[model samples]
Target: MRFIARFCKEKSEYFEIITIYDEHNEKEEISKEHPSIKTITIKNPAGIWFERKMHDDFGIIFEDAFDNRPLVHQERFPKDIHPLRKEFTQTKIEETPYLPYKYEEIDGDGVFQVAVGPIHAGIIEPGHFQFSQAGENMLHLEVRHFYTHKGIEKMLEGKRLEDAKPIVERISGNESIAYQICYRDIYLQATKQELPLSLQKRHALLLEIERTIHHLTDVGFIPNDAGFGSALSFASKLGEEARRKMKEVTGHRFGFGAVSFENSFIDIVAFNEWLNDLDKDIDFFEDWIMDIPSLWDRFDTTGILSLKQAVKYASVGVVARASGVKIDRRENPFYLKHGFSMANEESGDVGARFKVRLKELKNSIEMMRHFLEEDETVLEVAEICDGEYQSFCESSIGELFMSIDIKDGVIERFFARDPSFMNWQAVHIMMQKDIIADFPLINKSCDLSYAGNDL
Candidate 1:
């Protein structure tokens, strides 16, 4: 563990840069192990007129350098280029020579390569998956992405404190609410702001609703991988109904405008009616899981990712929970006060992933009901303004994290880590020892966001 930091003052401009490098390469003693290199870089805006006290602003970036070396900074930067420096204006391009991305080479007579897309069958994002296969069994798989890179982080620069939420929400269309909440919390923390108790409950309710509905879509697709068309159709219908109910309450099928309370609030009577219907649908789905022996046969022991691999890859969210890795942010004291607990399954297979989501779905529903029943008069809102707010609440798919830096009453920088950003690599692990045909089942089990990853 090496920690390096320095402060430079030149011509009345101030700059501070901090870097931590792990010499032993040991995992951080946290609830979960993430595979990406951990790196921190912070840049505070310079100004002499600002009267506010100097505060530490931390920024963490995770990535690997082209040579497979551990790195946390931008992958596109050359060794000599320091783009974050104050003197650097325009981005210099083509300084680093192009190098073709390497893929796993399979040596044999029968082995062959199959290229699957920058386009796909579903209305999905573009990304290529190269598979090395011997007949039907896959020897290696490489995922190539960044075709849709939108430079989201760059776009955040110079934005007002209140104006960044919409851009953050657009990071992933399916997981919009989670992104919004995470970014909001980070900004609130940096600004020393707080939300009312009623608003907190509302925030949590949106999270659970997002989780339940998204899980319904993911788990429903698992059966489809096994040629169970009816199951997929049923799950999609229920999931769509859940979305419609959300739109009815939040004015967006994906819960778009719900983040800003000025635009929305949950109606208890209508929400209760919706929940009652949803509960019945869940019961039907549960019964189907129990009755269908083929479903079990397809999912059980399939896409088996060992607990060791889960830790090695730092898998988070549903995949990690299914593998018996207990890393739920909701267990943080903040959410515990709101009644949150970790959920897990030990098998770490497609079946285990499905089971974990089902169990979490139940937990979300229970939490929603409990939140709805809380006393309204006591649920006071907290002021959002310059303080650190770090609390854990669950997202529909997995844990979401954000950190914001504010200085002199202006937004300094914002950083967020989506669960998909780390867990996409888990797909390769899940593919191991499984045939090419099982790709859909294993891939849909994780249901990672390509846009989130590319960002």
Candidate 2:
């Protein structure tokens, strides 16, 4: 195991292998089983750099990089390159696969393969899911994305700090605030700029509000898939209303041009009134969901993920929280911002996650109310600081991480990692024995945004 780790470190690149073991076992004990992972002092051990070589020749700032590790530092990221830091030049040589793709040679009857979209029913985004099933039950499910990939990382080339807002907002329309806040925070960190206190508070409150409504959608959708219509109808209605009212709070719910109450030009009073109305809606959603959980027995302990797998995949947010993996970016030591006691659940299933999200909505609504109740003068507030850094938070699905780099008054580079990249990979393992019909249910339950991931 030690030797493999050494080889991987030397051959640092994307998709390079790393060692993982049972969560209950000691590190030394796991090393004994796989004697090839080399032992060494590892810096920036939490984020991706430890997983690969340094970034391209540009500024790359990872949220998990230790102070002493230049490999993960912004300076090490190569300049004149791309997001993944992969090199691209004018002249290139390419090769094709030796053999064209072919079907699996399974030696059994009633074993079939089903290919579901890069497109699907109901206006969801594109993704290719190939399922190898025995009759109706799945034996293997492969998920391939990038259908909507528009070179977001590439499009960011030389974009000004403010210029990137449109692109950032487009990353995932549903995750507009999640992406916007991350982008702005990074730019601020790199440039040593500070957001208005009102903006900071409002951004946090809005993010939670997004999570609340987004969670409401997932909670309803998953049950709808389980053939429970009543729960779906009510939950979906709650989510729709929550989203509408949330949009009402910010003049543009999607959060375009939303800068700390939008100055004197916008009506702050109207926004507060909307938030007040949404608060009531959330209370009703919680009360109703409490009763609906008793109706579905399958949602209780279904799709259980052990702590080992959760850690291996680096799952975040509700997915990890449900399975006893407790990591929240709001609480991350590197962020150095406001601190809040995070809420979580231990049942490790659909119902339990639903419960946690509901509790979360209650907290978020309170934050919104607080912000709205305060006077607009708070927008002028500020706290200045020095040094460059990255910030992250738990979004609707999992951890959304962002990094910022500033040179003088300009942003050097910005990078982000959506939970879908990691959590989506775990679906193959989770759906190993799940039924075919249950695929959409499980997938929607995660509710990973395709647009956010396409980046």
Each model's lDDT: 0.64, 0.58
- What local lDDT score does residue 418 receive in model 2, on the 0 to 100 scale? 75
Top TM-score prediction, candidate number: 1
lDDT per residue, candidate 2, 375-419, as tens digits?
354433233233334666567776776654444534444556677
Which residue runs does candidate 1 get wrong by more than 4 Å? 1-66, 69-99, 261-265, 337-341, 373-393, 408-410
Candidate 2 structure lDDT = 0.58
Best by lDDT: 1
Clashes of 2: 16
RMSD of each: 8.5, 9.1
Question: How many backbone clashes does every candidate have?
Answer: 20, 16
177: Cα error in model 2, Å: 0.5
Instruction: Please give the distance, in angstroms, between residue 237's alpha carbon in candidate 1 and its true position after superposition.
Output: 1.7
Report the alpha-carbon TM-score of model 1 versus the true structure.
Answer: 0.78
Worst 10 residues of 1 by lDDT: 45-54
